[model samples]
Target: MVEIKVKRHEPALIVPENPTKNETLELSDIDDQQGVRVQGAVIMSFKRRSNSIKGEDDPAKVIKEALAKTLHYYYPFAGRVRETGHHRKLVVDCNGEGVLFIEADANVTLNDIQTQIIPPCPLLDDLLFDVPGSTGIIDCPLLLFQVTRLTCGGHILAIRFNHTMCDMLGFMQFLYAMVELSRGAHKPSVMPVWQREVLCARDPPKVTYTHHEYEKGGDKSHEVMNKDESNIIVPGGFLFGPEEIKAIRNHLPSHLQHSYSTFELLCACVWKCRVKALQPDPEDTVQVSMTVSVRENNIILLPSGYYGNSFVSPAITTKAKNLMMSENSLLYALKLVKQSRNRANEEYVRSMMDLMVMEGRPKYKDHLSWMATNLTRKGLEFVDFGWGKPVYSGVPRGTSLVSTFTRFKNGKGQDVIAVVLCLPNEVLLRFQNELGKFVGDFSPLISPTSKL
Candidate 1:
């Protein structure tokens, strides 16, 4: 492994070029209250231009200029988040205090980092801006940007935003706006709509459906963040080529053939593999929790540009013994995932809101729970800023959340998927063995032809 070296430049504060007078922006229930516990970040790497290209500004200058101009519209990114209201709801304090911007130079190229799949931590962790506390929502910078230049003329762009401000969809939309401005566009492709009042609870606050994601349990024992090397889980990156996806589809039960989508099938395979890798007691119940978007299925319907957290994670639980049933365990798991996914409708969304209001949202700290999220079809890879689309992009390995990312289009125009997994080091070997059965004789390969 090459010792990756980085040189840090002075950090500058970037405020919106045109500031909005001091004001507070109330967040939607789903956006503000739900995600106040975690931070959302994306790391994207870009290649430097050739010397033959004439009159190109410094990449940092280009990014900073465009960011400044775009911040006028997305000014909330330049703000700080603070708690307000009797129920302790979060609101963005639109004070014109700027966001932190960092510029650094690395001794290695993007390929060097990519070759290692996920760069070593302290090194990987060094690439992004840091926040003080990871759990509670407090007065913190709503946005942070770091641009590290590589010796090979490539650069890594890492952006971190408070999850209370927006969801993945919302975050990508903001990025798209900045990219468009950098490429000399006068206006953004999609305008933002921040009508948090639209998501306010109804007058009566009715609960029409049951939400399985939450339960009545009070246990706050002050669990410290696990940082011990012996306790650290080895992160693994897996690729599911079209061929592998096809094999899994073919293996679906005869009666259920052609009914499962690629995402469902992949989730089923991983959920079961993880259960087996953990080797929990046979009689214990294990659960898979998946997040789904409610923008499309909401009864009242959010606006086209409503950028907020409009998703929910509904969990499905099954006995470890039953989940690993030799004959049709995978099929059975897929069935449960599909059934729980079907609950992302309007009534369910309403019920989730009401339940949170009535029960005062409890932190779901189940040791046996695994979270799976789908970022596959989102237009993250398509975000280009003149240099070209990213060779690779995804989140870092700091959490147990399993995310499926962008499907790049190969020369043959085939969709290639990447699965990012973080598991206990002890269980990784068994997880790989389980995954290999589906991808037979294949290994993790990086295809950088094109990003979606």
Candidate 2:
């Protein structure tokens, strides 16, 4: 068992430089995120050094300053969420109450922690700023930050965001803006667009396409959380190099081999491998849901800087027997995944919004359901705060609902894509075996990118 010793809890509420006196910002319908409410954290590791200009270097101080400056533009994050219209509407009270910031010390070094590979849950959780017990999801602060100083002259910077506030892209856009401010840039390169009203449902709310991905009729009371831990879900990171990616692509049919991208192919492989590892009943059904950026597919074109939850939940479902019995299961799954991707067009996105407006946010649950999202090209690796770029940057396993795929360098500086998978312990072993067969002798546990 790993222990995280907390030195102190300092709630630093940095108000925006230019505050909005009294205003409430209504979130887009997409912000009504379906699924469980848990604080999601993104952890970034930076090494400490002395600065001649400042005499002493402190990441917390620099980050706080940068955050304050950046929050002036992205002030909605520095506010609190409040309910109106008898809990029908969720809005951000832009009172500039400020975000929660904490300062802590850890006894471990950068090397002591499992960052590049599968990180420890306790250590990762320790990096997250604690949410007050009295605070629930509906009324909690939208943003929180924590700066943890390691014993080896390295520090960990972790930020937690309410999923309802923004998607991964929006969250990173804000963080990147802060990095620019920290680098002495007066303004962000890209100014955020807060025209969430554009996403509001139309007067009539036309639903042209059928949204089969979401259930239509269901009793909300029957939707209870799955508390069973008999088949404990374990998250691990699996690396796939260029060769492995090429091999998976080669497995595709020559007739339409060039139609698929690396992400689609890898999604197919992981989906099939995970299903096979689970050893579900022959007649059981499985579903693989991947998040698609709605900004690219929305009927009303969103600005480049539109930072909100603009994503369509696209899922492909099939029978376990069909997948297990197929000679080329990966290819079969690839075809299905591609089909789902193709369907996430303008019509589908508009239809999804209409579906939510009509059906009232549906909750999907099933043991065979798996979710995946790609953040490989989100510029997370480019986050710099004067000390240097982060050796490791991304979210840890807080929920098994979604597995985020990102590319990071290895010890040898070789580029490898990491698939963060949270599965049963026994299934994890089998899943690694399947992944190894594809990526020639792939190590179940590999060293992270930074040895510097």
Candidate 3:
């Protein structure tokens, strides 16, 4: 067994004044769409400073001290979930569980925490981040802190947050404030903007959509869909190295008639590649859904700090068996994705909003669901809490039916895109092998022009 020094942070002292409860917002009055409820998850990594000289005190104690000081400035965070009569929000619960700390053995890796620890946590398993609890305030689903001793004689702290309450920008701001607190700083230059009223669903709401809209039928909803029973298969989530990502990008043709974004091009290529790798029936139709945010749709210009669950419209493209079997050009497939995205705009959103307002939610159907979103534009890299920059980040679990995409800044300063998908174990291995072949064959074509 690999022995390593380990330390744990004891729960903080709770004041009687604070109590755990749930916050409630009136969905009936505003838009009744279930998507209005926002839930967010973030993972941050921290490295220990090598030159720091502290006495013989336990390292866990030092880290807890740093966290305690940091929590003080963000005192509201220390409280538990509480519910008021109607309004649901985070209330100060003196007796709250506070933050959790687990010191893993040296053999434990970040992947272990993400896959093993995070998915099983009660808070995350319950999916309580969005639901209104008995407390008036929304509970911080599960704020996890995993400290691992790396082989290089340093430590890494991984923090994950639920997205219901905060966006990427808001979470980063809060993180920076925590860092300031750890440093014993009194004030952070950037204060948090707790403007929830602006993002709340409309009053006397014009639309009343429910979870039923995205379900196969009114019987089984998207939220309630059982992954084990559903035909929607997801492969294992894996991270790709720089060279691998470069090769995938190089597979796209440089001489295209219409210009296509990297995401659009790559998404198309990956979708087809995934289908081919799975050896799905050639007659089967594959549908690719891309999420389009309605923040700038002009219908509703959400305030800068608006942190509510906004609209995410899916743009879909379907390809038949013949097309999938006969299509060798990745660019051709990419055009389909590009066309689908360009077509879904303000008018499309308004029409959907009107339909949702008039008819409520729609039902999910049989289709191969795949999506890609750009996180690089969301300022994920800028989120530097006092512990330096995060070494790794991700949303560990939740949606297994659909594959999600995120882009991050790699060490080489290149945009590294990640695709998280789920599929059968055997299919997944085959997919990986196919990806390896595509990358190997494609890398040589782009190496001369590559920036890295």
Candidate 4:
């Protein structure tokens, strides 16, 4: 456990190179949901390059210039988000102020990273460098990023963004755009579009389907609502390669084998494992909330380049007792997870939008909830900057209570999915033991092959 050191420089605002429109943009309901209102971050580790410009000159200056040019086309990101109207609806104030950018140097290399590139990385505060008072939703930069040049010549990009502006896929669009500019592209291949109005509530507002994710909580214990901070919470990333995933899949009954997707199966596994780790009351009902995108294989059809939040989390609830039932418990949880996930159709999204407008944009804040988002195919790991595609790219760590599944290469060079979870330190051992039974060597082994 050698101490990691980072030398940082002054932070500055990077506005678009060419002044764009100074008008405001209204956000969609999916964008400003209370659950996602907080800051979201991603940490990328780029390996050292020999023939690239990013490898020759100062990586910070090169990326800084690229960021400014990239912001020109996607200028909304250079704006700040503020609450407006009676509902506290959020709108982007395109004032051309700029996004926050910082440059730093690290004394570590990419090979030094310890696994699956999950959250809870050491020296996170040093890597991301959150400037004072720069995190507020209103009158604050919509995005902030720090690029740390490592001793081995590689660079790491740690970025924090206002989630209300876009979802994971939308965020990657901006990253890829920046990458293109870093590599000398005049403009992004896919033009950035700003049509948040399309995903807003219907003309009169109508709740056609039930949106259970936002509904009030079920029967929860006292600790569930008012959590005790006495226990230390640890964020851990669990890798599930083809072999590990197959091990869990083999447990399903023959008839139900094909019924579950990889994301649903892993979520159910983690949901049950977490329940066991926490030792919740048997009568207490728990919920696993998963974010489903409405863009692909759904009813919503926005323009190809629209980069905003267009996803919803649909929660599945079941009693703790059922999850403790023998090997069949995984099967039961799998079914519930798959069923809840299928609700991401167009009607559900529209109904959710209407519900938000009709109910004044409510936040349920369910006590017994866990967020399981699928980042296995968000197209982040594939984008190449001047150096090359990142060894690991995705989120940094737990969002207090979140599980992100991302594409990863295990120690054996096998492509896999890493399911990252955050839990109380006391129960981490128990949680690991429970999951360890599924497959041998399930722990993440990339050696910071990444951290978000």
* Comparing 1 and 4 on TM-score, the stronger one: 4
What is the C-alpha local distance difference test score of each model?
A: 0.70, 0.71, 0.47, 0.77
Tens-place lDDT digits, model 4, residues 427-449: 77788777776655645332344
Which lDDT tens digits does candidate 2 get at residues 1-452? Answer: 23447575667777887755568888877776455244566777876664423326677878889988998989888788776663255688888888888878887777777453233234665777565652465777777888887777778888888887788888889998998998889999999888887666555677877654565576342232245443576666666777678767666667766777778888888888888888888887678877788775554689878898887767777889877765764778888887777777777776766666676666654467777788887777668888777777766563555777776665677666767777667887888777666566444343333232
Q: Record all residue pairs in model 2 with backbone atoms less than 3 Å apart, i.e. clashing.
A: none
Residue 145 C-alpha lDDT in model 4: 86
RMSD of every prediction: 3.6, 3.3, 7.4, 2.8
Against the true structure, candidate 1 reaches a TM-score of 0.89
* TM-score, candidate number 4: 0.92
What's the CA error at residue 243 for candidate 2, in Å? 4.7
Q: Write the per-residue lDDT of candidate 3 for residues 66-118, one digit (tens) a residue.
A: 56655544444455444344333222343445665555435434333322322
Candidate number achieving the greatest lDDT relative to the actual structure: 4
> In terms of lDDT, which candidate is stronger, 2 or 3?
2
TM-score of each: 0.89, 0.88, 0.66, 0.92
> Which wins on TM-score, candidate 3 or candidate 4?
4
Full ranking by lDDT: 4, 2, 1, 3
Worst ten-residue run, lDDT, model 2? 219-228
Superposition-based RMSD of candidate 4 using all C-alpha atoms, in angstroms: 2.8
Off by over 4 Å in 2: 1-6, 36-38, 49-55, 114-122, 219-231, 246-259, 296-300, 444-452
